[model samples]
Target chain A: MIEVNDIHKSFGDSKILKGITTVFDKGKTNLIIGQSGSGKTVFLKTLLGLYTPEQGSIVYDGRNYSDLSSDEKSDLRAEMGMVFQGSALFDSMTIAENVMFPLRMFTKQSKSEMQDRVDLVLKRVNLGDAHKKLPSEASGGMQKRVAIARAIVNKPKYLFCDEPNSGLDPRTATVIDNLIQEITQEYDITTIINTHDMNSVMEIGEKIVFLKDGLKEWEGSNKNIFKTDNEAVTGFVYSSDLFKRVQKMYLEEDL
Target chain B: MSYLHSIGQYFLMIKAMFHKPTKWSVMRHLIFKDIDDLIINSIGIVSFIAFFVGGVVTIQTALNMTNPLIPKTLVGFATRQSVILEFAPTFISIIMAGKVGSFITSSIGTMRVTEQIDALEVMGINAINYLVFPKFVALMLYPFIISIAMFLGILGGMAACVFGGFASLDDYIAGIQLDFIPFHMLYAFVKTFVFAFLLATIPSYHGFFMTGGALEVGKASTTSFVWTSVAIILLNYILTQMMLS
Candidate 1:
């Protein structure tokens, strides 16, 4: 489980992530969702220790993340895997080399064993045939899959994906969402994804927290999100065209 | 305080440079590439320079000879001194600044802006150390080697004088050859060392701290080359004044 408590951050008096607190449960896809500049990315980055919070603590599996030494922080990071906003695969390496990177750097596994693991992870992501291809050789969807394959190749206890579906088509987006959800459930890993994609929330939100202007506006499951009458939640949720239609259907159901 | 942080970061980068697996390979590749660039690419130029410089010095010195008041051989001495004091240390650095210096800046800057460095950090690797140390050692060593090569190339230039019959072999030897000045060699070594350090540090520093995208990387590369080349030329003058005294 991951716990964020009263996290406060500021960049020169312009505060972002003000006293925000939430819990992301294990064995589920817990999402932090908000519009652009709403602090969802900031919160995710803070949780990943990218931005050091001015106040509060991040506790992951009972360890105080803020207080660890450099080595300790690195140790914590080893337990973590991140998929960047743009699927930041090393351009110099082929897909197999990229996937096998963490294993090569952080472990003592033999080359063939590493290859087997790389192959298995690629297959798991439905990218079994792409081991020899470069990231540029693949489509954006395939690149995201390669990023996913690289992330899980390490079998990290915590998985973090930032804007995984931003540029993908809806069909591709759903496929990526399902992949994240399935992996979260199968590995029982505590997965935190930062995104604005409501489809992702409705599809895999075992737990979801909504942020607005750096504050926690609401927290609930996918089932309750559409039904909640909360003003801020409805305001943000209803603004989405799909959610608007969902709200229309919901209001008409009373007739 | 920012400078202190920058210093801290510099050391941190050097540390990362040492610890990375790619550091050795990249250093090896850059060195091999530098050698090829210096020797192969400049072969025609070096030959032209050696031939003309040797011919010109002997002819000029022989004509200026007034009843052998100064040995005609003194021309070779002047050329050798010119090679060591200014030519090797300054001109060769200009060539390298354009070549390897720009290359380092651009490559590392691209890595920085692209978040590859951040990825390394995220993975418990020291990004700066992984990038800086091998280059540092290489820069520290390679400049001296290049300077020596440049000095030898100049000597090859002087050889043309004797071969072309512009000056006698004995005149050439007597004029240029002298008991090695431990002090002059010391100054030459110092100049090479300082030049190497500046070449590595400035470019690496600029590249490592880049922001924005590919455009910023190109800017950094251009800036690094400009600044480091200017520094080499400026330092050449300062060393000459200080040591020649």
Candidate 2:
């Protein structure tokens, strides 16, 4: 579990993340949903220590992130995994090599031991036959699966995905979302994903935090989201005609 | 002012390269890979340029000596001086500034645009040390390539002198051995070593710090090539004045 106090971040004279506080629980899919330029990426990067907040504190489990020494921070990083929006697989390496990279960097396992673990993770991601293919040779969905495999191969305590569904088709996006949700449950890892996909918000959003212009606008699960009277949340989530009809049906069913 | 900022940032990057060194096992593979990419692959171009340019210098010197009072061996002597003093080291490095420098900048810039560097940082790796230090070590073997250029350049001069009937092979050999100052060779090598470091680091700094997409990668490569060539020429002038004058 991660607890964020009133953290504030700014770039030059313009503020990006206001004093926002939230909790991302373990063994759950925690989603940060916002429109473009709404500080979702900055907030996620701050939680990952890519950006330092000017105020407040981030406590991972019981340890404060800012209080840890450099070495301690690095050690903490080793226990965390991240899936970038582009997958960010090393173009020069094969899929197997990509998955084996973190293990090679951080583990004492022999080559065979590492290969076995890599194979297991690839299989878990339903990519057993893609061990030798380069990232460029894989499909878009396949690349995302490879990214997920690489992220979770180390059995991290925390997992973060930045716009994991971007550039993917709706069907492929659903697959990636379900995979992340399943992994969060299977490993009981604290998973935080930043996304704008409404489908993802309704599907895997066990704990959702909504942000608008750098402020926390609303917080709720998918079940409670339809019932919320908050104008910003409703306007943002049900902006499409299809979703507006869905909301109407949901409200009618609830009534 | 931007140039000054980039200069300061480049030095800071060099300083950061020594901290949190990557595991030697990983570094070893990276070094070998860079040596193959930056040095071994560059040999063909350097040698081809060196050989043909050396031949042209010999032919030009021989034709210009229309006065019967000048010795035929002077053709060999002039070729030796030109090849060793400037052609093999400085000119070849400028060519490499276009070839190898563009390569480093474009590759690293692509990585930056694609977020590969961020991935490394997220893994707790010092991205500069992981990416740049291996190139530095690989370029340490640069003088070896320059040495080959010097030898092949002189050989090309010999071939041109004999085949073109400008001078006898024996006379050319005598001219090459005539007044051979060992210090001149040392000076040439010192310049080569410095140029090698610039070739590796300047492009790296440009590529690593660049922000943008594919079009900006191309811009960074051109900018790196221009700056690297400018640095090499400026440093060559300073070193020549300090050492020779």
Candidate 3:
């Protein structure tokens, strides 16, 4: 549902992304996995039209999003949702207002109908009674859930999340990962997530794009990531303590 | 300019300015916030005007006196002239440079840095028209009101001198009307209008370029205040030469 063709981005002399290209498919969780400052955020921003690529085209569904007019781009964005890294909730607004922001801005729905949609989404995220609470009042995990509720409130056709599980505990990360996976499957929406969290890659990575220093390194699934003989993927996956143990466990079993 | 775009941008800014989910019934109440700030902050502002300017000029003119035929309350003549020409218009612009100009820059700059302005752009809103227009309207309206307040404040300080037995009422009134030109009053009012316009536009310009974050907003606000104050003081000199001279 999203295609990036030879995208190149530069900040003066510093090249952030050097000709990276990838496709994120529909009805699955597409994970862009990389270390911090690995240009994943820049890629996601390029896809969101927050940054203009120095060279390349970004096609969302069928529209040339990299070239659309501002109004047209906004219209395109209206069909999409984003879960920011910080949850980026408007501190001045309550949880309910946060979720209803997209609905009120994009949809012509009346106040009651908007409230109904807001209630439905909050309940869907298992946050029914928590709508009155502020984002500051919620825990990191609950805040992630609130962000999820806000993202899906408009029923967007495509959802982009920049590390929805970044600041959460393992259990909360898993919960958020599962919610993203479940939402992707249920709506058959194209969801692309940028993450450094290895747990997310293993849990919900139906399609994975691995990047190292701005170039696409390996493309694989969680089921076969350990089996891949590629040195880059092996080094990245095993560099983590948990993945190393998983590798050792499998190696001992085979021996 | 496309008619569609103009109307579209107008509505888009209205949307963002009201992006808060709560009901807007408290808009009138927020004006009271502005008043509270003005009343409290304007005390220091008026003191600086009254002491260094109105009071000091009176004492300076008193030092130059040699003619016993000239009223001893010649200081009151200097007081009325400087308060009307210098204090209200020029000093009030300096006050607005800190108060209102800095406020617009910081508020809009904060919105810009947080990507809130981008959110408005993504919503098809003209980030400029939406952010700048209403603030410009408010700045234009409010500083003129403060100018009147400053004018009265100077008169109040003059009353303090009279009550302290510094100058008799008859001598003060005669000295004030001695060379009192109606055109000088007209010139000062005209300059207040110019200062108000400059106060709004300069800071709004500084704010429109904000992108980084809170640090950037603070930078924009400081720049706005400094530049606007300097602009006001310099313009005051030019106008003083052209009109008051």
Q: List the residue pairs that clash in candidate 1.
A: B13-B128, B13-B129, B15-B129, B16-B129, B16-B130, B17-B129, B17-B130, B17-B131, B50-B157, B73-B175
Candidate 2: docking tier = medium
Instruction: Name model 1 segments beyond 4 Å from true.
Output: A250-255, B1-71, B144-148, B159-176, B230-245
- lDDT (Cα, tens digit) per residue for candidate 2, span A139-219: 989999999999999999999999998999999999999999999999999999999999999899999999999999999
TM-score of each: 0.84, 0.98, 0.81
Using TM-score, rank the candidates from best to worst: 2, 1, 3
> Which regions of candidate 2 deviate over 4 angstroms?
none
Candidate 3 residue spans exceeding 4 A from truth: A132-134, A248-255, B1-67, B72-76, B105-115, B121-124, B170-190, B201-220, B237-245
DockQ of each: 0.40, 0.77, 0.23
Error of 2 at B98 (Å): 1.1
What would the DockQ be for model 3? 0.23
Error of 3 at B39 (Å): 9.9
Top model number, lDDT: 2
lDDT ranking from best to worst? Answer: 2, 1, 3
Task: Please identify which of the two predictions, 2 or 3, would achieve the higher TM-score against the true structure.
Answer: 2
Residues B47-147, candidate 2: write the lDDT tens digits: 99889888999999999999999988898899999988898889999999999999999999999999888888888888999999999999989999999
